[model samples]
Target: MILHTTEVTPLSGYRLLLRFNNGAAGEVDLSNELDGEVFEPLRDPVLFATASQHPVMRTAAWSNGADLAPEFLLDLMRVQQGDRAA
Candidate 1:
């Protein structure tokens, strides 16, 4: 999941538009999944947008003192697959 540009549009929930280096794109909805301090900063749209521009996006913040993980993306991907399945 090597991405080129990741544009995150925060809707009613947190939605991410991931554009991969290979031209593949996917979206991740992180509404119900995150409801803790790790997501608190993201409540601020500006901070969230800036974080999304980082190399690893939210994961980096989560890694450095923030309470979250890179696995969040995998979970989101699973949710995406589930949506496609249904």
Candidate 2:
């Protein structure tokens, strides 16, 4: 998923205000989700020290090294958003 943070605003607690390129803006509460390995590094103050240090873009490749369809990206985005795209 492409997480382009246009503006980041600190909430009352550990939540963050995220504005995506699709114009779907929402607050992702990460207070409890930060315990996982993928998000554990985000707790470090150094990662945020550099604005250029962002998550790497990983393209979805098929078994034959072929690029996945555009629908796949959309499906992934929906899954990440806690929705099952039918």
Candidate 3:
């Protein structure tokens, strides 16, 4: 089954609350995830907190044009919850 993000809310300091369509939710700290050129703009607090879910994409994206893949987010959640992906 393909996973899609239902919603994303900015928490603090590169952390975000993510809700998935599969009823799984997690708080993800993106501090370590942010890297390279595409994520440079997100270093700004205001931009980091601008996480929004794209209706069409159904993924979280920021005003700086940075976005996180659903697969990556799901894996992170799985690890955080101490559950390995099957």
- After superposition, the stretches of candidate 1 with alpha carbons farther than 4 Å from their true spots are 1-13, 19-25, 53-68, 83-86
lDDT by residue for model 1 (1-86), tens: 54334333334456565543434346666555556766666665555544343455433242224433445554465578773411
Q: Any residue pairs clashing in model 1, and if so which? A: none
lDDT of 3: 0.83
Q: What clash count does candidate 2 reach?
A: 0
For candidate 3, what is the TM-score? 0.88
Scored by lDDT, model 2 comes in at 0.40
Tell me how far the alpha carbon of residue 77 in candidate 2 is from the true structure, in angstroms, after superposition: 11
Error of 3 at 27 (Å): 0.3
Model 3 per-residue lDDT tens digits across residues 9-35: 998878888888888887877888788
lDDT of 2 at 11: 51
Worst 10-residue stretch by lDDT in candidate 1?
Answer: 58-67
**Could you give the candidate ranking by lDDT, starting with the highest?**
3, 1, 2
Judging by lDDT against the true structure, name the best candidate.
3
The regions of model 3 sitting more than 4 angstroms off are: 84-86
Question: Which candidate has the top score in TM-score?
Answer: 3
